[model samples]
Structure formats: structure tokens, C-alpha cells
Target: MRRTSLLAATGALLLSAAPAAAAQPQVRIHDIQGTTRVSPLVGKHVADVPGVVTGVRASGASRGFWFQDPNPDNDPRTSEGLFVYTGDKDPAVAVGDAVTVSGVVSEYYPLSSGETPETTANQSVTELTGASWQVTGKGSVPAEEIGPDTVPQAYAAPDGNIEKTQLDPARYALDYFESREGMVLRVDDARVVGPTDTHRSLWVTTKPEQNRNPRGGTTYTGYADANSGRLKVESLAGGDFPAADVGDRLRGGTEGPLDYSSYGGYVLEANALGQHVPGGLKPETTRKQADGELSVATYNVENLAPSNDPAKFQRLAEGVVRGLAAPDIVAVEEVQDNSGPEDDGVVDASQTLTKLTDAIAAAGGPHYQWRQINPQNDADGGQPGGNIRVAFLFNPNRVSFMDKPGGDATTPVRPVADGGHAALSTSPGRIAPTDDAWKDSRKPLVGQFEFRGAPVFVVADHFASKGGDQPMHGRFQPPTRSSEEQRTAQSRLVRGFVDDLRRVDGGARAVVLGDLNDFGFSPALAPLTDGGALTDLATTLPPAERYSYVYEGNSQQLDHTLVTPGVRADYDIVHLNAEFHDQTSDHDPQVTRIQP
Candidate 1:
């Protein structure tokens, strides 16, 4: 769980400072794991701690064994189980053997190898290091059962420093988990809320009735509504982890040691797995646009490039063509260049676009033409050298791109008065390319198009991603969203530019669409819809079908499409990729049919 292996930097230091062979304190496991979240006996020497071995991990990069005291102290604030980190050596222990352990107690704040407690906002894993054990006899401790009714409804207490707070298992969920940090827990008929990943892990909800969406997942509406009943499950003994989709049931029961890691927080390293029962989750497709309507869609074809596998292009093309029913215009994000990710200064994406469009044509869709402005070499901040940018793809027979020649990487696109309406100074141009709000981020591309002989200005945007922000389950309550500052500034820039377009013509048809990377109700989304210049279409969906992305079992929205008053739009967030196991991209593409 630490940044390094079991022999953590802090643990190695504590091991060297072990006390002499003097009489050590005879303490119980509950006294070591006090009422507070942090152990009071940290960095102290303990002798002859009694426990029974419940699980052993003698093989892997993380090798450890878990033991639990057979008798509980009748206090909910203390746990009986303990994990013995053997560093790289194997511990000769069995599941039922009783042992007396003598070692130094240390706190390894998993994942913050170089960070001290004052510098990091992460919880620590209290373990006994530099340990030697003696086999006493045979014993067993039945694992404590965790169920839907047992988990607290309150997610977090909003306390300032959670590490010093007393355990309140009757109130908050975070405290309940902390009270039983290294204990063995069991779940029966656990419902899968998040799909299995490549690292042999999946998420299951203890409370099935909380915030459940129509797609068999939990819905994350705002910051305070985080569902904390979700628990991560992984195999402990390198056995195969069970694979299941959303709503699938892990029938029978699954029992294991409740270990903590930096990746998923508290995890159930299962020694006995449950049977996987399929929930029959399926992908959803939307209907095609009507004859007199223009369809516009936004998709994040995840880091697509020519060097990617053919199946990647084909699958994404199939989603655009078949799942979305072939929208007339598509604003694609993360379109990498020909020499994808190779820092050779090659920034052209003609080959990548051509391949995608060809695959769409082969999938029985219309012939599409693409337009894009390549960014300066490594100017955008995606992968190190994968010059990812936003681009447009339009069906030539249905809509025509107004081609102008003055657009480049650094020039800002302008609006000009033409025939009592607004027109772009350069078609397929970047909006405020030199603005500080868009520094090292993908610039918004504004394209002018004519659908059914009417002027339509489309602004394609891929705003700053949500990196560098603290996790929802971090030590800080109501996690800090520092990344939203850049997105809010970028939204204001887009709002100002759209206002300029409307000033020229009060009835300007502007469709702003792409991966916005912020929630629909966030402060960052207010600027785009605050002044009435545009109406956010993401709010038009029902509560059950609102999200376009799923993260850690919470379905949420990140991609969006907004429209000015001149265009009458009907929005549909196609639920193809986000909910299913077979995903071409991590996001679900959304389309809007407009009648101008």
C-alpha cells in the first residue's frame, strides 16, 4: 500500500530503533488501536500480542499475513485483526495457527512515501514491523459481517482533521471503516456497482437502495451526495478475481481481510470468492435525426491515433455510426496525430481522421469530411507527446463547412457582421488561442457550417481535465477542486466570445459541444448558461439517465452540449460505452437534434 514495498522508509527506520531485550508492555490489540483513528501506541515496542492467522499472502510484490484475536473487547471502536508485513520474506504461517508476535508498531501512510503527516492528507495503515513470531496452538476468529443495514447513512462528518477524531460507528461511514481498519469482514450476495478492472478488482455496494440509478449504478449528483457504501474487492492469494457487470450479484458469500491501499482506499482482499451472476447489462443506442433536423454530437475518442489497434478505430466508428445513428456533425476530442505519442514534432492528424471516417463509411454510414487545426508541438497537456486536440467531422451531403484560410494554431477566431448576422473571420478556427485560461490546454475550435441553407456556428471545446484535484475519499472532507479554477476561467472566455457573436446578430445559432470535464451543476458550468447566451442541454435529461461517465461506481456527467435560443434542440445522452464492459472509450457520446 505504501509508495515502496512492505519495507517502508519509515518502517525501516523504526525497525532499526527496536528496544533492548527489556520487559515490554503487555498490551491487547484493542488498546493498540485506540478509540481515535490513529493508533496511540505508534513507534512503541509491544511484546507477545496474541492472535490467530486468518489469511496469508506469501507470494507477490506485496507479501503479508493477517491475524485476528479470537475474543473481541466488546467495544465497536477497536478492531481485533492485525496485518504482519514481512517485507520480502515469506512467513511460515497457516490459517488456523495461533501465534504470539513481538515487533515495533509503525504507521505507513500508504502512497505517501516521501510525504510526512503534516504534508499529506492521506490515512495510514498501522502495521507491526520487524516482527518475529512463535506458534502457540490452533484457534479461529469468525469474521464480522458487513451488511446494508450495518453501514451508516452519513458519508463523512466534515471534521477538519479526521485522523484525530474519535470513532463514531453509529453515525459516519468513514469512521466505521476506520474503526475496523485491519479486521476480517464478510459480505453476502454483494451487488456489483462497478465493473472489474485489469488489476483483479471490482466495487460492490453494501446499501443497494442508496442513490441507485436506472442503469444499475449509483448516481453522483453533487459533492455532498457521495455514496460511501461501495467497497472494493480483490483476490488475496493471486487467484482469479471474479468478473461482473453493474447490478450483477456475487452470490453466496465473500469473506476476506479488510486491507487498505492507496488505489481504492479500503479493500476486501478475498480469500474465498462468491459466484458471479450476470446482471444482463446492455448498451443503448439512439434514434437517427429527422429529415429536416440537424444532429450534432460530442465524443471523446480516447487518445485515438494511427498507431492504435485497428479494433480501437473500428469500435469507435461503430459507436458513432450505429450507436448514435450517424449524427450529421460530430465534435471529437483527444484525436492524436499520425506519429502518436512519439516526440518527433509531427502534429498532423489527417491519417487518424481519415482512418476513423473510413471505418464509419464501412459501417454503413455517410461519407464524412473532417477539419482541425493542429496545436503547437506538445502545446496541449494530454500524454507527453500525443498532440491531442479537438476536431470536427461533418457529413458533406447533409451539411457544408464554411472554409476560410486565416486560422492557425495561435490566431484567435473573430466574429464579423455579414448580412445582418454574425460570421466567423476564419472557419474552423481556434477561440482565444493565446488566452492564459487555455495555457497548455486544448483550445476551443469554432467552426462555421451551413445546414439546410442556414448559418450555424459550432464551438468545439475540450476543457482542462480534472487532474490535480484531491480524491472524494481523501483525508480532506469535501475534497478541494483546484482543477475547477482553470475550467471556470475557460468557461468565462467561451461566454465572452459567444456574447460577441450574439452582439452582431441577436439571433445567433451557436452550439457549444464537447468534453467540458466539469459537472453540470458546478460553478464552472454556470458561466456558459448564466447570462442566457446559451441553455445547458445536460439538465434536460431525467434523473435516472443523466450521466455520460462512470467513475468509482458513481455515474456522473463530464461531456455536455449547450445551445443558444435561436436553435430548438432535443438532447440525448447515448448510454453505450460508460455502462458496459466492452468499452471503446471511457465516455458515453451525446447527440442533439436541432431545428433552426
Candidate 2:
């Protein structure tokens, strides 16, 4: 429900102290320094400011260079410039070089953190034109001499208050490094804890110290060696640097080796950070049905909800029972529910689907039945509308629900972390779930059905959203944390499932349908077609009728129904009324008739 904006910057404007002076054509260092304010200037040209380079640190392949006024006492405003660091050029300015930089002060770009608000602190820099010269002035001293020495702060600490407990060295070292964020802290009596395949490093433990606040209130303080503490850096300027040893003095802000949490953490690389990881439920084989005629259809029942009041369950029984096609098997996506009354509230979608089955039979339609995989009670992803899921509706006369294999039949489904959770997988990418991670909800539902006299299998898939397309590429920027990869994996798993079925029953039939979160031509759909397992129904229609959703005022097809080669031969896939583009659902329905 929270529509993600793929826009690069949030369009946040920093208020400036005053308007640009009319007399000056270009902004000068004095103009920026004279004003005690910041402004948002997306495409403005500014003049160069000269200062002494106080610090130069290589970040990945780029260098973060900081500068201070020649007369620090006279000019209080500090300035800095960042440049992409290529190894070919010797850095013109060292720690003590005087350099002048001319570039526009730009707004910070936001980084994605699954389930967290995007973070903004680092700004982007471009068009660097500067000169550097060696300075004969006194050099800046290292950070340690400026402050008093103390024990390094450990990453994790015991639950008990630090003041009362005696420090246990071994356990202390193990826990601290595990809990601390990316920051530098001094440690005492530190020892090598473990070694990773890439580097050998030590985890140090330190005791807490008591300190007084500005109001003379006492508090506990921790330390780091040589002012040594963890500093989260985006990356090293170059690759494969030597690891810091156990006894090595660590400067609090000095960049160090990457940590486990680094991938989804604060210091992520610009290129890799804030991306969605893909994931999904992997399908298990179900019972095969006997040969018989069956009917299957896919519907994009636009945003079907329980009611205006999110608290009340919207009755879908009437709609399903009275639907024009009266499908024997229905794959409905975007069936919405929510935690609040104003939003799509707690209408049990499974129960609604069940009611619809009974309603259809009562209305002289087929005696249909249904099954659904509900998202977790706590899985609140979509915006104010609550949550949406795909449900399977089938005629009992056509198919029987088989117990999913390889798992306890009665065992309750568990809510594994979605791409939103960092601890779930280490792939550094998000893919849709292909397993039973959807015990709570927010996953595709699968089942086996008997079509009159033949066996048929179906997977009701509702992929992640391709909400906003990227301006430059005209493609939906996949979600952060490898989310696109997870979806890709889910597609592959579906293809594999279909392939396995064909292998078992030389001419087995299968159907895949719902909102795929992808276009007909997307790379994610390759697996389904590559093995000749599924054929897209949209391809049967003329170019004008292909799309089901609209973006940037243009209609695009995202909802689809695909059939296996064996199934397509006997069934005619039809796209229903989609021209209205109404609010009932974001997608129109597509019905398929299986011949006897």
C-alpha cells in the first residue's frame, strides 16, 4: 500500500539564508561562507572556494576530501568535496595540500532500508575543477592525542547494568562485536576472536566507565584503542587491503573491514545500497487428477475489498457467484484485507473465497470450493489499504486439494522474513518466496485439481509490484535488497515445477495466472517459456489489447494467464472485458476453456 517512489531524490529543499546577490554572476566562497544557511539548488552553477585539505580518505574507488579555511580562526564554515578516486592519478593533494573546489551544493540522495524510512546524509558531487599545492603550515594531529584514553566500546553488552556487573572477558568480547553499530570504540585486553575466509581480524572487549554529563549527571562510558573504534565506510578506495590486526590502533572514524551487517547497513556502497531483494514460495508436487474437462480463468478484480469500513469483511460471494464466466477454477489476485477499518480490514479472504464457492452453487452455478494462503497477522506491507493476496477458487467437482508434500500436514505456516527482513538470507538480493514462508500471508497459493477425466496442476501467483518505472530506463526499478532477484528466482521455481510435472506425465497440463508484477516481455518470465512449459495468453490478443495496468498515463499489461503446451492445445485462452479500466481491479479478467 505504501507506493514506493523510484525518484532518485525526495525533492527536499534546504532553506537558504538569503537570495543570490544580484551583483554577482557566480557564487563565490565568500558568498557561501557569509551566509549561515543551506539551500536546495538542483541545477545551479557556483564558483570555486579555496581552502587547505585537512583530510583525504579513499572510499572504495573514490576519495572523500575535506578542507578547512587557511585561517580557521577567521572563517568558521568548514567545506568538503568528494571525488571518484582512480588509482592512475597520484592524489594531487595530500593531507597538507591547499586546494580550491568549484561545484554546486546538492541535496543528499536517499538510501533504502527494508521497513525503515530512507536515510539521507551523504550528498552527491560532480564537475570537479580544482588545483592543489603543498602547504608549509602546521599539520593536523591524529585524533587520539586530542581526547583522553578509554576502553573500546563493545558491540553487545549483557542485560545487567554495566555499573554493577563484573566484566567477563571471553563472553564480553564475543557479544560486543556482535551488537555494536558501525562506530569506533576503544577496547581493553582484546584478543583474536575468529577469522573469515577473506580476512583475519580480532574482536576486542572493553569495560564500561562512569562519566558525568553536561548537567553533572553521571553515566557509563566505553572506550576504543588508539581512539580506535569502528568507522563504517562505504568501501575501501581499492580492493583487498590488509586487515587490521588485534593490537592495531584504530581511529574512531577510520574506515575498517566490512562486517556481516554491512550489506544492509548504513555504510552500503552507492551502487548496491537500498535495492530490494526478491523471494517467493517454492512449490511442492500435489496429487495428480484423472483425465476430465476443467475450466480455469485469471482475473485482476481491481482492488476488491471487504467494505468501506476496513473493520468489516467485504462480501465477495455475490460477485463470484454472479460473474459472467462462472469459471470452474478461478485465480484471483489483489484480494485486499487490512488491519484497520478505513483500510482493507480483516475480511478473511479465504473465508470470502469459500463463501463465493457456496454462493455460486446456491445460484445454480458450479459447486465450487476454495483454498488460500493468508499472510502473517503482522505482515503489513501495502499502504493504508492493508494487505492483498492471491487465492485459488475451484469447483469441488473438478479438483481436490492435496496435502502439500515434505512438510507436516497439520503444522501451522510460519512467517519467514520477507525481502524486508535482513536476517532471512545472505544472498544480498531479494527474491520471491518459493517455499512455505507464506504461512502468515503475502504469498502465492498453489493446488492440484482434477479436470473431469484428466489431471491438472495450478499455481496462483501474485508477484511483487512494479509500481513506478524508472525514468531513464522505462523499467520498473526492482525493489531494494535484491528483491528483483527473488522474483526472478520465484519465476524459475515455477518453471521448474512445471517441467517436473511434464517429466512425470508426458503430456501433463498446467496453468499459471495472476498479477505477475512484470510485463509479458520481462526477463523474469523467461524461465516459464524457455522450457516450453507455459505460453502467455496475452500474445493471442492484438497489440492494442495487451495491457492491464496503466503507468505514466500509458496502459501496460501486468496481469496474465499462461498455459503449458499440452494445455494450450486443448484450451482456448480468452481475455475478458478490460477496456473499461474501472476501479474494481487494476487488471481485467482472462478466462480459459478446457475442451473435453
Candidate 3:
């Protein structure tokens, strides 16, 4: 908690016992780690700064060692530890080795591939570069416990940019983590929020009760409640990272130096790995629709292709047959063409749809027929040349698809009055296919279907993905979701189309469903459900069960299904893929049983 203001001068130090050097105050780790995020002593050289080695990252582009001063300052705003960056060169230091280091202080930012340090909303890691250290003696690196009380309720400054803000460990969690950068810390019996990843890492939250879902993981409901108690863990070199699923417990605990990384803002490079305790979490299956209930479901199959592993196709089919209970109409998104990711001109997905239906039949589900308007080759924003599109799979014996002609990739179908009722000009048509709102994105696939001799309009949509948006946890607080702009426009366009249907016939039975690629509460989503033209059925679920996708340890809803106000429907978000580590797709399919 100690704080010190260094000499106002900003230049190279003599690094010698000269009269000029004598005038400068003695340097400490806290002095370099100033009250603010940017180091006050940056660009200045210091010699004989004393500390003990707490950890060493021997590999990677950021090869370095962390050291902490045994004598700490009382100012909680300043940290007592620092990272000595020996980029590409080995420090050859071990834990518990008391050391005096000499180097130039600087700020380091881990940039993504192709990102330059010139301009960004990213934060910097204060470190000592061009450094040399000598082992003075043996000492212990202190480890602080991060219990429930350690994290503050506030996530960060309201403005989101906490870069120049002074450290307030007692208030904002981001400031608290930034204050302890490069310091040893410990967490006990941490609960897994984000599941284990292929990178040998997982996210665990210290405060287990903060946003608990019935399934044992934290939920991300909005921008304000970010679940700040979350922290990342990784085992030391040559050790296996613990494997755990959502709601699983990190038995015992993990201890190590808290380092910053590009993968996540902060990381605990674990010297002692935590044991994984399973939480008995399993995929959930929904009850099938009763007779006369025309069930419609939406599932983002995660870029499925005919060339993918047969197992994946089979699992997806199993999910549709059993997990979703074989809904009468399934709106499938991300159905890649036969070539998958190959950058060829193949845009036909008949092979892909055929493989899926065959698998569904093999899994003992209904023999389903598919309908879709294929997008232009490589025009849709997905895997190159895959030309992914939203499609429909219907049990022809139960519900029949109307056969109106003239549907194509670039053709926009208009809403027409069919015998005093609302109907699509074509059985399968693309909505505003050439509009800029859907540029390089999947167009909404609108189709007309019949059940019990009554016609119904269905709009299957896969809005733009949130790819180019800034990271929510990045230095830019409440980071800008620029990608949402497109989706918002997409929502408004689809909403207008839905309203057109409602105007055509006051009692038009319409179901709008697919991977909207947005949260139910998002600004983009609000328009779709605005004016009561359509009801976001996903919102009817218990708050804890609303999520359909999991990203960065935050269980959130990115897919949705909506229906006209006059339609009576029962909705269920079948929790099958997201909660489980083993999955057929990243998105959970939602089904709505609508009455005829």
C-alpha cells in the first residue's frame, strides 16, 4: 500500500555513485509502479532496485521474470512488484531469489497479429527492459489471497477508459488487478466460469455467488454486470493444465504471478495447479411437442460442411433428433457448401443438407426435406468459399412447404397478398438480398409453409456476427460494439418485413427464428420485438436459462426466436452444446411449439 513520487526529471540515470546520482531519490518497485496505470518513471533508467523473484516466463515473445519488494509501501494505489522483460534472452532466475535489478523502465502492450502499437484501445504492461539482475540472497515471494472480499463490486470506471485513472483497489476490480500486476496471488476453490480451452487455460471466479446460474457458471446479462470476479489460470512449463467444464470446481486452488496477456487481460501463471472437480453438468434435452403442436426450432450448426468429420455431422443430427426432439420445422444456420472452407466456386449445399438429413434419419428422427435460397459463392461472410446460408428442414408429412418459384441468391422477394392473407411472393425467398445491410452477410431467408391446410409465413435469419468489435474486457471500458451496427440495421430491416406481413393480414401466423447473433436485450434485438409486431420468445425463459451461447466464461444469449403477437407458442432453449465442453455446435438450439 506504499506510494512514492519519483524525481520529476525524465532522462537516463548515471547508474553510478556520482554527485548527480546522489541527488535522485532511492528507486523502489512502487515508485516505478506509480499511482496511475502508466508508469511515472517511464523512459528513465534506474539501478539497484531490490526485489525477490516470484515467477519467470521462460518462453513466448514476452519472455520475462516477475519480482516483488519485500518491503511494501502503505499506499494501496501503487504496486510493490514489477516485470523485468528480457525479450528472447533468458533471465536465469529462480523463485525466492532476492535480486537487485538495473534497467530502463517502459510500457509494453501485447498486440494481436497485424496490429501495430501506434493506435488502439489496448492497455500497456509496465516492465523493465534491457535489464540485468544479480541474485542478492534467498527470500520468499509473498502471495496474497483473493477471496470474495478481495474483488470490488464495481467493474471499472463508468466511462470504460481507466487508462489514466489512478488505482483504486478498494473500488474497481480492473484497477485492483492492474494494481497487483506481476505480483503473486492465490485463489482457493475457485468456480469455473469459462470452461477449459485448448490453450491449456481456464477462467475461474473468486466470488462464486455473484451471478450464479442453476448450472454452476456465471451469467453475463448486460454491460454493467460483467462478472468481474473472473480470473484466468495456466500451469507452469511442462505441466498439464487442469480440465474442467462450466460449474465445475477448481479443487484446492491455483497460485502464481498475476501477469497480463493478450489472450485475456490478466492471467495467473500457476506454479501450483488446481485439481479439477466435476460438477455433474450434462446436456439438457427438451420435451417433444405434443400432437397438433407445430414445433419450430433454430440452431446455428457452426459452419457445418459435407467434408467435416462424420462424427460432427452425426452428433448434430443426434442433437436435432433427441436434443431438440425433432422439431417439425428446423431453421439451421451456417450450413456450409460441400467444399467447406476450400476457396472454390462451389456454393451448392445440397450435399451438406443431404448429409444432415441422412444423419437425422439414421438417428431415428423424421425423414426431413430441406429448402433454402443459396447465396452467391464467397459473397456471404463466413469461411472462404463455404457460402454458408440459413436453411429450413421440415417434416413434409407433418408440414408442407408451398412451391412458389423464382428464388435465387440476389433476388429480393416481396410480401404479397395471398387470398386476403399475407404470403411471400415465392415459397423460398431472400429478404433485401442486395441491400447494404446484408453486404457480405447472410440474408434473411423467408419462406411460406402450410400445416393443416393453413398457410404461415416464416423468416429464418442469421444476422451479422460480432467479429470486428473491440473486446469487452479490453482497455477501452464498456468497449464499443461496432459490429452491432450492422446487426441493428439487420434487425430493423427484418422488423419492417415482419410488420409488412402483419399489415397484410391482422392475424397472419408468422414465426421469425434463427441465430440473430445478438443478445435478447441488445439494441439490435429491441427493434425486432418493438411495437409488438413480434415477440422475442427467448425472453420468456427464466433469467438463468436464457443463454444460448457461451463466450469467454460468460454464458450469454446471442441467438433468438420470435413470433407474431397473435401466435400462441411455448418456447424452450434446450441447453445442449454450450454448457458442455464436448459439443456439436457452440450455439444451443431454441424451439417454439406454436398452435395451429
Candidate 4:
């Protein structure tokens, strides 16, 4: 590729008429888009970059015009397009106008509120700044197509190094973005995976088939693979655009310059969007299981604090009654303290549970009795002062709690043989409370109950979250899941408790439910499901419908339920939340009915 190093000097003329004046060196647009994320000639001044203006963002605080070379070099590692940042200058250059500009090459990163002025993990976008351009000639913009055939595979190369020279441009999203950083490209017949963000950024995919998940976008289940086909389309035309829901298709696709932003990775700032194709997804109806069978459910009530919007409590109650059919017991996660988001020493969620139970009753459901142990102040890892802990809401008429002196927050509950039946030493107790595996994470809440004269044991758990994991588009090829180690240990601990119950009685009706935080297919769950001691009901569902949570664009299962043999259980994931735009919780409640 051609490379030119320009000195940071005053504006120099490309062609000097004076015999004594030296001619300024010219650099190809591809040269400015170096082999890496940062330009090779960054901080240096370059003159006479000839290309056609593809698109322009004249207004806004971060405004720039997109330009591309009509004829590109055969080097696939370098992009032929570049963005010229015109600070408050109403550039007279129009689309299709060939322009020769002079500018200092530099990388620009938009600072987040309270963010420092240095490049950390979050801020990483390269751009050209302090530019001045002049229209040279007029020509039609290039219409190069980048479809499924050209995009990279969802998973990065097996090699661990992201900085390794990009051998193939259409193999990984990171490599593809590096190869075509500023190039003007088109995604024909793309499918919208997620609705537009507040900044009008829409996530879409040109390949809707190959590595596609049942729910529009791709998944990170097995190999932590990302959907390389998925791309973000940012429209800076300065007006409200109708948002597209998941499964919607964009015929003719989007055509624009691919750029990077701090919030989202490489995005195609679309100048034109094609025809809209509706996905035709309808809301699911309430479920109906056989009567007389005690039904239980698991729901992560997304930081349901008392100070939250009153409508949130109402919506959750409606979802529990109408959507989930008001299960006999609900293993609720993220139940903040009575003070809600307030950071006082208060750890009781009685007021929060009472408000929720009262709402359920108002919604024509039976009055629900709740049980939980208030966590130590700031001990449980959730919103600070929120003291989020797992709790159970049970209908006394259907099933009654087998109370045997509940354990405190720091007390660990041990399994004991009770009249040849498996029984917890302490009801509504914490399992392995002081275990290092649960070091700042939520502890498993164990409760024993009697359903129709038969004793059943249930455990409510909220394992370590996947927040500490690396992004799919990080420097590591297959991003390491550092959070899985702690979760695996936590799973083993729960399984040990479950095995104890089964040891007391092989025919034990043990039910494990709540927001496990790990996927059913992830290796972190092998400890619980490997030997078949516990069967995950979600895995038995049709693969496409196995998810209970929607993140980014993939509908995945973060909440799960496992039951012992002889306990015939059927599950129904109430899709009232997650998929819908107006959601009270990020997770859909999973209802399981146990027929004794």
C-alpha cells in the first residue's frame, strides 16, 4: 500500500506554481486508514486526498463528511474510505462531488459524561480531524455491495491475537471493520435484529440464515461466538425515523460509510435505508396447565425497589396474574430492600414484597405469603443499599411452608434425613452462605414445603452475573468468560445440596428454580445437569423457544429450573416481558408445574 508521512505545518498547496516552492506529497485515502485501528500518518498533516464525497453530517457537535476513493487498491486490509471532520464549516461539497482535501490525521473518541480524556476500554474510535476540503470533480458514488457472502463468520479466528495481521476481511466482525473502517458499503436484504437505540442506531444482519439464532440476532452460548453479520446502522439525517422491531427485514439494505463510535462498535452511518419488511410477531397468550398441580415460577424483577415507578410494580403484578397464571410459588430475584434504591442500613424487603403481593391481590390473584432473609448491608452484590436478595412468594392455600426454624443470613443450612424423607435442617435458609464461590454474589435461598401432604424442597438461587465477562468484540479472539469459574463453583455447591436431598430419599421431589444467570447450554451448568441428577426443563423445549431473556439482539435463557426424577414438571416461559418494547422486567417468568 502507498504510505506518506506529512509534517504538521501550515496548510500547504498540492501543486505549487512558483519554481522555488516544493510540491506537497499526496497520500491515498487507504494510506490514512492504516493496517491498524489508528491511522499510520496520524498527528501528521497530509494534502491532496482525492475521493468522492459519499455522505455528509454537517450539523451536530460531532459532525463530519464521509468520502471514498472511487478506485480502491487490491489490499483488503486497508479501507478505501475516510471521514473528513469539518469543525462548524458548512462544507459546500455535495454527494458525488470528487474532492481534494488537506487535513491532519488523528483518532477521535467521544467523551462520556464524567469520563476521563484518555482511551480506556470504552473510548476507541479513530477519525480525521482539522480538515479543509475543495471540490475537484463530480462523479457518481460507488455502489460496492457487502452482503452475507462477504461478511465474516460470527466467531473470531481460533488464534488469540486480535492484532495479528488480518488475513481475511470477511471472516470476523473485528477484522471486517478494520478492513473497511471508512469505506462506503451496502448491506442488501438485511434483517433488523434490534430496535433503534435512542441515538437512532439499529442492529441488523445481512446473513439471516447461517449462524443465526432463532431470535433474530446471534448468540454467545457455546464458543462465545458473535454474529459477524450483525451491524449497527446509525442515521444522522437529524429527524425521527420509525423504529424496526426484531425479525423485521430491510430490503435493498442500508448504504453508507462504516464508522466507529464509543457507545457501539463499528456502525454503518446509513445515508439511505431501504424498504421495511414487517416480522409479523404477535404477543403470546397466557398459559393453561392442569389444575390441582402446584405451579411455581422464577422471575428476576429487575431491581424492583420501592422508589421505582409505581407502574413497574403494577406491570409486574399484571404479568404474574395474567401472563404467568399466578403460580403457587414464585422464586423472585432482585427484590430490593424496603427503602428501595436508598442506601440506608435497612435490609428488609417486607414493604417491597407487601406492595407486590397487594398488587397481585388487586389484580384478582390470591393473597401471596412471602419469605426471605434480609441480606447484610451491601453484602449481596446488586444495587448498593438495594440489598437485593432472593425471596419466595407462595399461596398458602396451595402449598404451605414447612418451617423448622429458618436460618440467619450468615448461617448455612445443612441437609438432614427426616423420617426417610429429604428435609432441610433450616427452612428459608441460605445454602453455603460463607462459601467463597458466593463471595459478593447472591446466596441460594432454600425452603422446604408440603404440597398435598407430600414434602417438596425448593431452592431459589441468583448466581454470579456475566457482567465481568469480556465483550465478544474484544482483543481476545474467543473472549474469556472469567465469571464462569465462580458460577461453576456455585453450581457444584447447589448440586451437592441437591444430592443430599436425593440421598435422604431417592424419590425426593426437589425443585431448583430462579435466575441462575448462566445459560442452560453453558459449561458452567454442567455440574448440575451432567449426571442427570437434575433436569433443566428449558433445554427440553424447542431450541428456538428455549430462551427467557432477550439481550442485545439474542433471546437467551439466563433463568432456569431443574427438578429431580419422579417429579413430573412442565415449564412455560411467559413472554410478556423481554421481547416487548414496554417491559417491566428484562426477564420473562418461567413457570413450572409439579404433579405429585
C-alpha lDDT of residue 200 in model 2: 19
Residue 256's C-alpha lDDT in candidate 4? 85
Residue 380's C-alpha lDDT in candidate 4?
A: 83
lDDT of 3 by residue, 1-596 (tens): 00111331122243333455336578999999999888998999987799999888888766778999999999998888899988777668888899988889999877886676655556788999878667889999668889998989788876666777877889988889989988889999888888777788888888888778898878888787888888888876546666678888877868888887777678888888667889888888888898889899999999899888999989999999998999999999999988898988888899999999999999999999999987888888987888999999999988999978999998888788978988888779988899999998999998899988888788999999887777665677778889889999998889888888878888888888888888877887888887778898867877767798878778898888888887999898888888766777888898999975
Question: How many collisions per candidate?
Answer: 0, 91, 8, 2
Error of 1 at 417 (Å): 1.2
Q: Arrange candidates, best lDDT first.
A: 1, 3, 4, 2
Better of 3 and 4 by lDDT: 3
Superior candidate under TM-score, 1 versus 4: 1
The Cα local distance difference test for each model comes to 0.85, 0.40, 0.85, 0.77
Candidate number that wins on TM-score, 2 or 3: 3
Clashes of 1: 0
* Residue 404 of model 2, lDDT score: 44
Q: Which model is ahead, 2 or 3, in terms of lDDT?
A: 3
Where does the lowest 10-residue lDDT sum fall in candidate 1? 1-10
Over 1-596, each residue of candidate 2 has an lDDT whose tens digit, in order, gives: 01112331142122234555567554433333221112223345454455554444443333344444443223322122223122233454555555545454432232334322123221122212222223444443222111222323332233322212322323333222222111122222222111111221222212212121221111112112111222222333334322422122233333221122211122211111111111111111112222444657676554555443322112233334444346677887766653322443354565445544555666666766666655544352444444566667776665655444322222322212333321111111112343533223245555656554455667777765543222211011111223445456667766765665565555666677777767666676677788556898777764444655433222356777788885642323232222221123334455666655
Residue 403 of model 2: what lDDT?
41
Q: In model 4, where do residues sit more than 4 Å from their true spots? A: 1-25, 36-38, 56-63, 84-98, 107-124, 134-140, 197-199, 211-221, 262-264, 275-277
Off by over 4 Å in 3: 1-23
On residues 355-427, what C-alpha lDDT tens digit does candidate 4 reach at each position? 8999999988879998899888888898778999999999998889988786989999988888877788889
